[model samples]
Target: MGHGWRTLRRKILTPNVSATYLETRGFRRKDRESQELLEKVGALFLAGYAHAVEASSIADVEARLGTIEHRFRGFAYEGAGMGYGMLDGLPFGHRHHNDDFLAGPAADQIYIVYCGIGWAMARLPRFRWPKAESLDPLLRWLVLDGYGFHQAYFHTRRYVHEHYQAPRFPWPDDESRAYANRAIDQGIGRALWFVGCTDVAEVARLVRTYPAARHGDLWAGVGLASTYACGASRDELVRLTELAGEHRPQLAQGSAFAAEARVKAGLWIPETDSATKILCGQDAETAARISVEMRPEHVRNGALPSYELWRQRIAEELMSLGGVSK
Candidate 1:
């Protein structure tokens, strides 16, 4: 498409910047610093999205995203991934944008990219959704994670407050369909971090409101968000570990996954370092190693997908460490 048309497309597709404000979303505003930090994250994401939609090539998008600060660069790539995914889902646009981007600039940020595709899924019609089989078998679940985050972030009343779950998600036709809600819940758990403004007590209360059976996955989500997003303080992270209680193993697993994601993308920051140390009882590299070592080789070997098995193994590994403690 021409530059003019692409600019117009970007303008039409991107949400207003204010949509991300906690106040605008009716989400909790714990304090000025926390709200500003989270809002900046949203701004970076939108900026990345705009770059992707308007760029002429993958190189063009990369050039723009490269300018983002090291700490927030991964999120920019994530937003770019969403832009590409959204374009691919459009009826008249190129169909291979997401694949090409993933093959090129997004190779290291694969986890964040897949989750970004889930963000696209939230915006597109069901028919326009990508085939689940097209994604890596072990990582496709991250797309649902992205979707869950989007739902809980934007539709808080339904997905968070009302405890709404997608009844029979239709994408990715497979036996794993039954486990879809759990994956999405993991995303919801992640969203709770933002929803509660990284308030450990509030986030814990929100999780507690859900049924007991769902707490494990939910706590895992919190761990991932807390570690990856880096909003909670050391004391708050300690409280999070304390609040996690029996689900500490799952929480640690999530922290490890977050460590893996940030380290793999070369986007490790001080906040991630602190969060991992507090939540996973290990340094970032060690936590990341645990995640890698525990990853399952076969995607379809068991009743659960390799993704869940990977998470389970990581949780088991952390549990052996006697779980994270204040």
Candidate 2:
């Protein structure tokens, strides 16, 4: 497809647009089965907290989260799969395996999990939602992908490009909003998760966040989140990759290559390479092309690899002779 046609195709077929026009504004259009499922998950956490939400101990909350993860797994390839939901969810009925979950149910898991985190932090009476500080370093580390998803869910959308560069601080509420503003709900949600864990140092925090709960999905989220939002130094990401190799080589590979992809696409800061410096033209087209080109080499017809084999090879090609410390 030509670039112009691709642009239109994206506007029509992109996942976020489906969620926006179909789910958020018109969720009630088809009786909101998907939204209701999300609410059920939220209510599970709310009830788990004895209705006090964030009042529960970390262990208690995590135990409930275990139950919630089952729902997410249902959306994964391992489970029954997302099946594009019963309503106007993102279409992947034709997708074979986990990509269906990646494109579809993953978003649902994120929004619902983000809500659960907020609920766990919130108290009644005043009903104030703190900045999620109550979640200790470990718990905060746990939701890195959901946090990244919360943001990428919006930033990756066609609407943000049609509207503006990205959302600014002092973000407007949905009642008074544009595509960028509303779409950034994903990022804003992730920011809260990030802030909750920021009290710890970047590398340590990312490492702590790498417990093998959701396996590759969680690691992939970390890879993208660190690249797009963590604002860590290049050296730090290298160290992060090394550390991830210890836990799961794929985790390391995912972060390493994801960082490379984002840098090439202008979505990330430049590292040591001068080539990347020029790549940072902030040209959206370049980013889009990089995204298209980033199909994990050798995967025919765009079958994304597991976190282990995904982008690490590309990262190897991009790395300089004197790269991060061993």
Q: Against the true structure, whose TM-score is highest?
A: 1
Candidate 1 per-residue lDDT, tens place, 47-121, comes to 888899899999999999999989888888889889988999988956889899989989999999998899999
Residue 199 error for model 1, in Å?
Answer: 0.8
Residue 219, candidate 2: alpha-carbon lDDT? 40
Which residue pairs in candidate 2 collide?
54-120, 150-186, 151-186, 151-187, 250-308
Which residue runs does candidate 2 get wrong by more than 4 Å? 1-87, 90-220, 233-252, 255-308, 315-326
lDDT of 1: 0.89
Put down candidate 2 lDDT per residue, 1-326, tens digits, no spaces.
25565345334422332333323432122234434543343233223323112212234333533454442221121111111111112242222222233344333333223333322221111132222233221122222223233333333343211222334422122222232232233233233223322111332343354333323343444443343334344454444555544333333333443344344423333431321221222132332243334444343211221212324442332232223212
> In candidate 2, where is summed lDDT lowest over 10 consecutive residues?
78-87
Off by over 4 Å in 1: 323-326
